[model samples]
Target chain A: MKRGFNFSPGPGTLPLEVLEQAAEEMLDWCGTGMGVMEMSHRGKAFMSILNQAQDDLRELLMVPDNYKILFMQGGAVAENAIIPMNLLGYCAETPPIADYIVTGFWSDKSQKEARRYCNVNIAASSEGRHFTHLPRQEEWKLSQDPAYIHICTNETIHGVEYFWEPDLPGVGLPEVPLVADVSSHILSRPMDVSKFGVMYGGAQKNIGPSGMTFVIVREDLLDRALPICPSVFTWKTVAENNSMYNTPPTYAIYIAGLVFEWLKRNGGLKAMEKQNVAKAQLLYGYLDSSNFYCTFVEKDCRSRMNVPFFLHDDALNDKFFAGAESYGLLQLNGHSSVGGVRASIYNAMPLAGVQALVDYLRDFERIHG
Target chain B: MKRGFNFSPGPGTLPLEVLEQAAEEMLDWCGTGMGVMEMSHRGKAFMSILNQAQDDLRELLMVPDNYKILFMQGGAVAENAIIPMNLLGYCAETPPIADYIVTGFWSDKSQKEARRYCNVNIAASSEGRHFTHLPRQEEWKLSQDPAYIHICTNETIHGVEYFWEPDLPGVGLPEVPLVADVSSHILSRPMDVSKFGVMYGGAQKNIGPSGMTFVIVREDLLDRALPICPSVFTWKTVAENNSMYNTPPTYAIYIAGLVFEWLKRNGGLKAMEKQNVAKAQLLYGYLDSSNFYCTFVEKDCRSRMNVPFFLHDDALNDKFFAGAESYGLLQLNGHSSVGGVRASIYNAMPLAGVQALVDYLRDFERIHG
Candidate 1:
């Protein structure tokens, strides 16, 4: 059966090869006599899987030896609160302050959840412009001696992404740590490991599956967890335990390990980034040339993974979706908050899939334009 | 290729039919053109799966309409902290007190986590007796109007289980809600859902896999989250959103849904309980009649799901495990804390598997005893 091009913001498309491999191994992984899900987390077979996944991920991203990569549950949403709970107490001020540069929905959430544990300072926000653009480094108002500066490198909902890392020193906050929520676009490009204190994301997009959050935190920041942090979520305990603090989402990690292997087999992050850029350009170029379609996000800051555009006539929206579905295009409807169409072309999305989407756009426009 | 009898406590064996069905649907789920993992959480196909799973579980457990079933992330370990965070604030007391009945490892952890949010009282403890027996209802020392009582209905690490509900009324504390962690034993038999305010478990053992936590909280107890509770883990928020407050463990829920359907087809909980009883009896009866092997947990309180035993000559432990592995029996090693053997026969483990195990026990004794 031919699979549809899945453009869902997250829990998005995965490589067909990875899915096939997982299916083949579903009943019995290797000759272990038990499936990955059925194996004991402490057993040798599963321990090897866990260790290999962590190592592969580390190698793929060129993660520094000083940074601890944690396999966690609860996605990016749980980490919103977990981050503050871990970092604020580490700073240990009379009233620890955390600065956030709110680029879109996710970073906005991060700051709000942090408000529960510490004083929050919105260093800058692009919400005043409907999240169409990212707040520039010069615009950021860093709080003096704040625990950490938070940013969402890619906003899945608003379709904006940071092309460059936040410069703490450029903003006169050299000692403050930089934390980023890169959920929608982690492996889509190469990232400098030393630029941030923490880089965390949900693995559903540009990786594999939901239920697992990959956190890369500097070793120095591991022990900053507040007394209230759950033992399993405390960075120090998790790092010390090698992310087996609990069961560590065995199957999700297994599937993600397959994805990391896939990444490595396909020329690593640089190659993935090159393909991703090409896919994004094809879709965006077509959107720019079309008279019947328009995008709300500023071009300079638009997300390569998520492209949110709207029909010239809103009345044809349902028909547009129906036509897209018939052509094997799926989940193109924009987020409810941003009413339109969204094409999430992540690392897993092939250039052929994007070309098919472009062909559909032209066919749809020829009839309606 | 034959599958082994897996007995590794949590993340133990799963129903073969469920695994087969999942493999069949791995590429394209019911003509939806995407695997279950690729579907958007908000999409109709995945939503139906989530709702159907919730409904089937509700029917199977006979959960009352007043109870809210929350599909949450983070396994039982994370819930050790989440439960206290959600419930303590509901009582609205200055430095609220919560009572815990420490039966074993899990209950001890639950109370220790509760200390972060509220004052915790150890109402009764079986640790003094090496967790071999359950403290009777009369032995529980009630706290004066504590917020709630916590218990680990089944201790996975140590094989003790509560066969009867805590009689709060008889203990003169009818008003206190009871929260039980039934991770290892959930769905093994019919549970009296009305007796507890909350029943939660990690899905790895009897349900499906790791990464998903099933939380059944009474409706009245929904809004009592402490000020610092993560919004995503808050019961009321998750319940209202139909477990879609965030991208839930989508694929895990789908696999669990398949298990639920399998449970229904196999004559529901009563039939499952009968088979479970037979399996437990076969294993325990063999141990009782054998001079070479013995179980640590008391007979009355032995968990049907988990059985921990020891070889009479500790030196033979390695030989016993190697022999068992040769017989296609796997994960027979006990937890590191308890150096012995544990056989976790969850609902998914058929009676035939237990029979094979008993046969192995007899054969090993004849050869080595």
Candidate 2:
């Protein structure tokens, strides 16, 4: 079956081959006489699936031996609270302080949720600039001693991204761990795992499905969970059980494993990065060329995975979405908080899909202008 | 393709029809260009899927109007912690005491988990009896003005079940609410949702897949969450957001909705209960008449869903399992904690599957007796 381009931001488009492979294996996975969803998590069949997924992911990211990859549930939203619950124990002092750099909607939400458990210090925020750019590293206020520094590498809603990792040494706080929410752009580009203390994300964006969350954490960071932390969400507990502390979303993990395999077969993260850059450029270049369309994010910090843009005539918003949908483009409607169109071109979105979307954008501008 | 019988405790077997339907709609759902997994959680497509699932579940259980159906992530094991976090707020006293009736393995896990948030009282325990029976109501030591009472109506490991709800009046704790973890047997029989303050379970058994959990919470119980409760796990937030507090297990929920629809089409809970009784009786009756096999749980409390039995000759355990597999009976090996064979016949298991197992058992005994 022919499929159209999907731009839903999350639970986004998967590779056609991945979807076909999943459908073909829906009833019997590799002659196991059982669907992937039906196998016991502790059984050999599922254990292999989970092990291969974790191993492939580790290899793909070049994750260090000291880091444990945990497949957990509750997405990035729940991890906001879970992060504080797990990390507060590592603080040497009472009322442990954690620093957060708020870039856009996701980082802001992360800081707000963290307040429930500890002393959350917002050291820097791009909100003053309407979240159009990342806070400059030199300007960030570093806490004297913090349990961790938090950042959202890619803001899905505001279309802002950090191209460089925050260097704590530059800010005179070299010992603090840096935690990043890399949900929207995790697999879209290659990442240096050793530079960050922890990286986590929901699987819906560049990964596979909506229900699973992956937490890649350094070994030293695993033993610091607070007494109140739910065992299932505790990184230490999850890592000890090899992410099988609970069921670990058997089918979602299987699908994610399939996605990881697909990524490897297509030349790993380097290839994905190359194709992703091209897709983003095709759409952004066209938007920049037309006066009728504009992207708000700064050129230096624009997200390659999510492009939020606006039409010059606000009156044409409904017509723009309708026209795009008719041409087989989908979910271009921007987030409610951000009033514009957002074309989320993740790793799964091909160059041709972006070209089709760019063609529609140009056609729309010509007729509307 | 012909499929073999799968008896996995869970992440268990699903109806063949559900798997087929899912594959058929893998690319497009209900004429929507996007698959269920790809649709935005806030969009009309996924919302319709979520709403229909909740509505169908409510209809199947005859849940009262005051009960709110919440679709959340982090399966039953996570719900063990989430329940206390959400319910402890209803306590009138400091440190809020909750009573737990420990029937078997699952109930023991529940009480141990609840201790993280509240003071726990063991109101009744069948542990002294090796979890082979439910504690009689008259023997229960009721806690005065407790926050709530907890129970696991069906013990998946011990192969025990409560045929009747614990009448708070009979137990001399009439005002307190009852919370149940009905994970393995939720839809196998009709339930009185209004009788319990909350009913929750992971969806791997009877429902659909892993990663999704459903909570049927009473309306009046919504406002009592502690300040430390994670926003996503708090019942009030989940109910207010209509379970869209996070992305939710969209694909898991979709498949569960299909199971609910299948249940409704197959004469609903009444028919299911009747068939379940027949299946249990056939196996239990054969075991009682045969010297080769024996069940451990008390007859009155033996579960219709999970039937755990042992061979008379302990040496033949491995041979019995091998013989059963040759006849297409799978996952009959018992949980390691309970060393014997266990056949878990959830709602998805048809009468024919159980009959085939019974036939295999008789044939094996005839050959080896």
lDDT of 1 at B78: 92
Weakest lDDT window of 10 consecutive positions for candidate 2 chain A:
A167-176
Model 2: docking quality category: medium
Candidate 2 per-residue C-alpha lDDT over A106-129 given as tens digits, one digit per residue, 9 for 90 to 100: 999999999998888899998988
lDDT of 2 at A291: 94
Give DockQ: model 1.
Answer: 0.83
Off by over 4 Å in 1: none
lDDT tens readout by residue for model 1, B279-311: 998999999999999887888899998899998
Each model's TM-score, in the order given?
0.99, 0.99
Which runs of model 2 end up more than 4 angstroms from their true locations? B170-174
Any residue pairs clashing in model 1, and if so which?
A: none
lDDT minimum window of 10 residues, candidate 1 chain A: A166-175
Residue-level error in angstroms, candidate 1, position A202: 0.7
Share of reference contacts kept by candidate 2: 0.69
lDDT of 1 by residue, A1-369 (tens): 779998999899999999999999998999888999999889899999989999998998899999999999999999999999998776746699999999888899889889999999999998888899988898888887799999999999889989988666766666778999988999888988789999999999988899999999999887788998889888899999998878878999999999999999999999999998999999999999988999888889989999989999999999999999999999999999878999999989999999999999999999998
